[model samples]
Target: MIQRIQSLYLTLTGIIGIICGLITDFIPNERIDMILLLVVAILAFISIFCFKNRSAQKNINYLNIIINLLLIGFMVYYLLITPGGDLSPKKGVELIVPVLLIILLAMANKYINKDEKLIKSVDRFR
Candidate 1:
């Protein structure tokens, strides 16, 4: 489980999600964004232990990706509505967190798929 590359990716995704939650104050809607970030983190962590079920793990990663995309959309909407227009320093490290999460989750999913294909090929010899 822990030795898998997808597990490592998921772990990083969880950590990033936690960091995003901690830095949520910079975003316009702190409460909602923080809750979402924490949820994503929890889901990522939970999925790590479900390595026995690659399909379930992949589904969880897909869910996380969707949530992160939603987060990015929320961040963009909030950033655009802020007073100082594009001139303000509203964009912060928090804005990049979701994108990073998505990338990590995608990589994890890729590895998961590769593992699944490999398993399928091996099982065919039985």
Candidate 2:
């Protein structure tokens, strides 16, 4: 039930994000918003790879957690700090895809939990 709910949420997020991204040109003022949607869409896409139950999935999950953390760290740095240049929308533009990628990785983690072998690896979101 939770999986279905999450899946549906992700599907909606993905669709809206994609649509927003496609119309980015028309909505120049919405670059940041569009980018966020794009990220959600990307996450949803990666979340489709879930598995089912496995005790050995810890290492994989741990690895994913690390990567997700790193990605988030980078995102924070990129979004919050500017080296010396103007702190403007243009500067943050570079972070769009990376943020999207991070969200995708998180979604992938969720997806990995679907493997029967990895089912045991997951406690919640069942």
Highest TM-score model number:
1
Which runs in model 1 stand beyond 4 Å of their true positions?
A: 85-93
Question: Model 1 scores what on Cα lDDT?
Answer: 0.87
Best by lDDT: 1
**Per-residue CA lDDT of candidate 1, range 3-105, in tens?**
9999999999899888868874555678878888998999999999999999999999999999988988888887777776565565655677788889999
Against the reference, the lDDT scores of all candidates come to 0.87, 0.48
Per the 3 Å backbone cut-off, how many clashing residue pairs does candidate 1 have?
0
Worst 10 residues of 2 by lDDT: 49-58
Error of 2 at 12 (Å): 0.7
Candidate 1's displacement at residue 111, Å, is 0.2
Q: Which residue pairs show backbone clashes in model 1? A: none
